[model samples]
Target: MLVIPAIDLKDGMVVRLYKGEMNSAKVYGEPFEFARAFENYGAKWIHIVDLNGAFAGIPKNIEQIKKIRESCNLKIELGGGIRDEDTIKQYLSLGIDRLILGSIALKNPTFVIEMAKKYPIAVGIDAKNGNVSIDGWANTDSTSAISLASKFKGSKIETIICTDINKDGTGNGINLDFTKQIAQASEIPTIASGGFRSDDELEMMLSDKYISGVIVGKAFYEGWINLRDIFVKYQA
Candidate 1:
């Protein structure tokens, strides 16, 4: 499985929030340095979230994103505030490996399918309260995660990143059962995100072949997860 480290951007600085709460954000220095550190730890793909953009409904960290794209060659999967096709095209034009549509995917699935068809790589799906959350994880609607994932059955979406909003940044371990159920229902591969705390948690995810990837954030930033050793051991 691909080990994707997260780089959440708020005001052009790397940060992480508790359960997607904007007020609980903690800045982690420069985005450039964070990207390099993840790269050095052997991250082949970087997961970036525009926390401000997600809440504001517009791209908020474009400048830093551009710098990271130019600085490192690691594949990037960016999500947050990507509401329409124009914004989708802009990011792809800049060479972002995958564009993850969260709010749009939950609000207007048709647009998600259209973008999936047009973009070479597209990912969608966000979770909350055992249901799918939309509009930047601000609201928990009635739609079930599996049901929503089934909509992309024939779409060109390469992967779907599913996060347990309740578990996010809690370091309580991923919602594997929920992710496994989604993976079983969805035709496309799935990536598990949020609450990935330790090497054992990641190892449990790795054991599941259906989980295409795992996105690590707080655990990596807080030194709870030693990514360098994890990568080296995995390689061995």
Candidate 2:
């Protein structure tokens, strides 16, 4: 399994939020520096989220995202505030490797299906108490993560990034059982995100055949997990 690093962008700065709360965010540094550092540490891919854009329904950190793209060679998968074809095309034109659809995937399944046909697209399913949440986890949809994942069966979705909101940024380990369920339901390779706290947890997650990769955020940024050693042991 690939170990992907997450860089959550808020107001053009790299930050991590507790439980997806915007108010609880702690800024790290410039996003490009983080992207470069991850690349230098041998990360094959980087996951970025535009926190400001997520709540606005329109991308707010395009310039910063573009800078990161230009400064690094690592494959980037970006999500948040991406709502239309124009934005999708814009990001692709900027050389992003993949686009992650969250709110729209739940709000308009047909559009997601259509987009998957033309581009390398991944759907992000953020769940709280088994129900999918949208608008940056501020609102809960009446659909279960499994139900939502089941909708993408046979589609060209490249991956399903399943994040457990309760464990997100809490360093409590991942919701492995539910993550596996999402992978099975979607019938697509899934990336487990949120609450990855230790090398053992990462090793356990990597052992799951259903999982394609793991996204490490706070655990990585706060020095709870060492990226260089992880790359040497796992990806190397």
Candidate 3:
């Protein structure tokens, strides 16, 4: 599986939120520099999220996002504050490889279906506490994560980014059973996010051909996992 590094933006600064909580965020360095760094380490795809915008329902880091897109030839998959057709169009026009839909997917199932048909290779899902959360993980609804994933059964959704809110940024480990269940239910490739502490965890997931990718944030930034070394091992 391909390992995608995460660059979560909150107020134009790179940060990581534990279990999607704003108060628990820990900031990193410059976002553009981090994007460049990931590219330098041979990353083909970079995952970015606008934490504040996701909650506010507006594009918070458009300027920073545009710079990253223009600076590198690397592909980017962005999420946060993406709600309707217009926003999706705007991001796609700017050339983001994929668009992740969190709260929207769960809140508006009909819109999710229509959007999946309208934009191919432009949709992903992030669920919290086994249920779908909306407004940037600020509110968790009653819908189960698996049920939300099943909504894309016949859509053009290529991959779903599943994050266990509890383990996110905790450096514990991924929710393997939950991920497998979602992967199997959706029958769509999944990108596992959150709580990865070591290369061994990544190696184990890579061994499973069904998993499409894994998003590494705190681990990569805090020197928990070496990108170059992990890339070498996985490549070999």
Candidate 4:
């Protein structure tokens, strides 16, 4: 399994929001340092979310994101405020290895499907109470997480990142069962995100063949998960 480190940028600073709430953002300084550190630890990919972009539907933390891309060797998978072809092309030109469509994917799967065939793309399914959430997770819809994931069955999409929004930044634990449904439904390698807590949680996810990766956020920022140790054990 891949241990992907996350850097969530809110107004150009690294921050983690509790349960996806903007008001609960905990600043952790500039993003450049963290991206470099994660790269040094042997991470193959870095997960970056422009918190401001997600809400505004336009890339807001461009310079901060560019700083990370230029400083680190890590392949970047960026999501947020990327709804159109122009924004997607802009980030790709800035060296983003992958683009994850979240809100737009929920609202228009056809557009997402078309984009997937043309670019290195992934689908982010942020679930709240087992239903897919959108608009930076400010709204919940009737579509089930499994149902939404199944929509990408034969697409060229790279992967599905299933995040349990309720558990994000809580350090409670990852919602493995919730992720499993998405994995099976999508029939694609899925990455689990949000609420990552312990080595035990990693062990459980590692045992699952369908879970290709796990996004570590608050757990790593809080200083418990050793990136080098995790990389050696899992990705070595």
Q: In candidate 2, what are the lDDT values of residues 17-95, reduced to their tens digit?
A: 9999999999899999999999899999999999999999999999999999999999999999988889999999999
Rank order (by lDDT, best first): 2, 4, 1, 3
TM-score each candidate. Answer: 0.95, 0.99, 0.95, 0.98
Residue 63 CA displacement from its true place in model 2, Å: 0.7
Residue-wise C-alpha lDDT for candidate 4, range 1-236, written one tens digit per residue: 88999999998999999999999999998999999998889899999999899999889999999999999998999998899999999999999999999999989999999999899999999999999998889889999989999999988999999999989999998888888889899898999998998888889988898899999999999997777888888888
Kindly provide the TM-score of model 1 when superposed on the true structure, using C-alpha atoms: 0.95
Deviating ranges (above 4 Å) for candidate 3? 121-124
Show the lowest summed lDDT stretch of 10 residues, model 1: 120-129
Q: Which ten residues in a row have the lowest lDDT in candidate 2?
A: 198-207
lDDT of each candidate versus the true structure: 0.85, 0.94, 0.82, 0.93
Q: Kindly report which residue pairs in candidate 1 clash with one another.
A: none
